[model samples]
Target: FTRQGQSCTAASRIYVHASLIDAFVAALREAISKLKIGDPLDEATDIGTVISQRQKAKIESYIDLGARTAGAKVDRCGELPGAAHLKDGLFLQPTIITGVPEDSPLMREEIFGPVVCVQPWDDEDDVIARANDSDFGLAATVWTNDLRSALRTVQRLDAGYVQVNQNLTIQPNLSYGGFRKSGLGKEASLEAMLEHFTKKKTVVIDMR
Candidate 1:
């Protein structure tokens, strides 16, 4: 969870194909288990604290919601730092949830913390539709080896930026923004300056 999953472009809702969901969850759990949670300044710390106690509480509330929701399973990882190390820091272990309903707040809203929701998909068309069925369309990532499938999925995704086999790889030169409720206009690149930041003026010359 980069930057404690606070980034707007974080991969919060992950939809894995039914065939690979089991293996993907297993691998994710294993990876999270090895993460060292402690001070951000510590070089060995793989996971750090959230921005504030409010944020930590908000994230924990979502985790609790997932736990109480029927058919949903929450898997929390990593060890909490000792009371001596915690002090006033707001640290939370990484959490992965599965079997959560598509309409659940955990899946619909951005947690903006070290929590991710994993859902299984069977049909490609249905999966793409499900991915698009969200208020936020900031970014999306498709992980597939088939070039044709990847390209096809990328074209159909209703997001401002779509990446194949990558996540949060936006460069400065690329025109960056979001669709729908994400944002209004772009931020970087020449086009952003010209279209979003610049005002156009038309001059007229009368007679000769």
Candidate 2:
């Protein structure tokens, strides 16, 4: 997002191998470029329909926000060929946007969809700042082979959960909740018990 000079909240994460920001970008480009938009039931489809026309419209608005508010440079929207067969389908192209600044309105909003924004950071501090600057603090993942970077990311990322070495963290013992508006409740484990429950004080000073 910094590239587009826009700001973003913690939507998702773009992890890198510490120093290879360029390589990470290249990989993201390749991965996003290859998504095939079509029917989910079809085994050949790489990408599938977005659910409904409202969802498609919502996703597109964010694209517009990225371009106008965040300064993100966007590629032309690709029309899915296979989806054309459907009379009224929710097929929308996968999008990859670059140049969103860490603090733009484009980055701060939550967009739950197939659109992935690949952002590069100079250091952990930079990523942490951008990651936390938002109203929604759902979840974030840090991908790194270095234990130190992973450790620090966990310590600094202001989210409810920080998954390391993987994009997802789903364990029975770990508790999950959002920092802001993303969510207010907790679930999964003992951690939730602490966050969700209120403590009661009982007095037992019976005239001893």
Candidate 3:
């Protein structure tokens, strides 16, 4: 739940290979459950309040829909903190929903909250297709030791940035942007600066 999943780069949808789904989910659940949810200003906080009450409510509704409408098994890993001062805080329990359908709304939309939906796939080609099926192709990540597969997946996935064996990281001096509806132009690097700052003028002289 990094930054309470307010980041657009957050891995809200995880398409795990079928063989590793059980192990991955178990590990994720354990890790999420152990995170410290408290005052964001506190140095000890791992998960914090999202942004506001409205966002909290929207996220909570998505979590509920993941279970009620999508038939996914929702696991709310922990409790909201009990500090009296934080009683009214817009904090949400880090949630993981598994066994969700590929086409589930929770899987498709950008929840932009501390919620993740997981679906399993058995075929590499199929998984690649499913991962690229989204309209928002901001960024994607592939975690595997197989270099060939990683490279292939990276090329096939329709995302502006594709990380191999890494998540939520950007290279220095590189252009950062999104594909499809996630974004239009780059954000960093010289390319972005040129795109916005420089104008092109074509002057043609015809010599008869």
Candidate 4:
């Protein structure tokens, strides 16, 4: 998980098609297994500690919540740093969870840590609806090769920023922000300058 999944726009709720869910999870597990968990200063380390112990606990609570869910499966990879290496630092193993219900808090809340929830989708409309059901709609990604399907899904998604077959990449020239509870205004670009950073006023003298 990049930046320990701490970014606001992290791809947390991954909705894969029913046909690909199995293979997707398997590949994800394999990829996660190779991640090196250790000191942040170490070049060999792929993942480091979260910001603090409180954040570590918050993420662990979500993991526990997923485990307690009836059908949800919690998956983790790599080993925790040994005490000799850890030295009281806060770190969490990257986690990948599947079969969590849509209504569960794990799916609903913004868990700003190294945890992700994978769910399967069948119908296009249903998947789109499910994706938009959340209060947070900052960013979304559609990973389909079909142009038609990608365009269709992209246009319908409620996120302020949508990516096609790419990870979240915020560029300086592009307007960046979110919808609903994600945020109110934008950052970067001209739109943000006019709408968020600047105020507009009009005055008329008695020309008549």
**Which is superior by TM-score, 1 or 3?**
1
Candidate 3 lDDT, tens digit per residue, 69-116?
Answer: 645699998768998999988888899998777777788888999899
lDDT of 4 by residue, 139-206 (tens): 99999889999999899999989999898568887999999998878987988868987788999899
* Alpha-carbon RMSD, each predicted model: 1.5, 5.5, 2.4, 1.5
* Worst-scoring 10-residue span by lDDT in model 2: 1-10
| Candidate 2: residue 6 lDDT (0-100) | 16
**True-vs-predicted CA distance for residue 70, candidate 3, Å:** 5.7
Model 3, global lDDT: 0.86
Report residue 25 deviation for candidate 1 (angstroms).
0.1
Residue by residue across 1-208, what tens digits does model 1's lDDT show?
9887888998899999899999999999999888988888989888888988888999999999999999999999988877685776888889999999999999889899999999999999999999999999989998989999998988999998888887865689888888999988887789886898778999999998
**lDDT per model vs. reference:** 0.90, 0.64, 0.86, 0.90
The TM-scores, one per candidate, come to 0.94, 0.75, 0.93, 0.95
As for model 1, its CA RMSD to the true structure in angstroms is 1.5
Regions of candidate 4 where Cα sits further than 4 Å from its true position: 206-208
- Over the stretch 1-208, how does candidate 2's per-residue lDDT look in tens digits? 1111112223344534347866766666666566555666877676666656786788788878766754567653345664347747766666666677766555666665555566767766766777788787767877768898778778888887767766444567778676878666777787677768656578888796
lDDT of 2: 0.64
Residue-level lDDT for 161 in candidate 4: 91
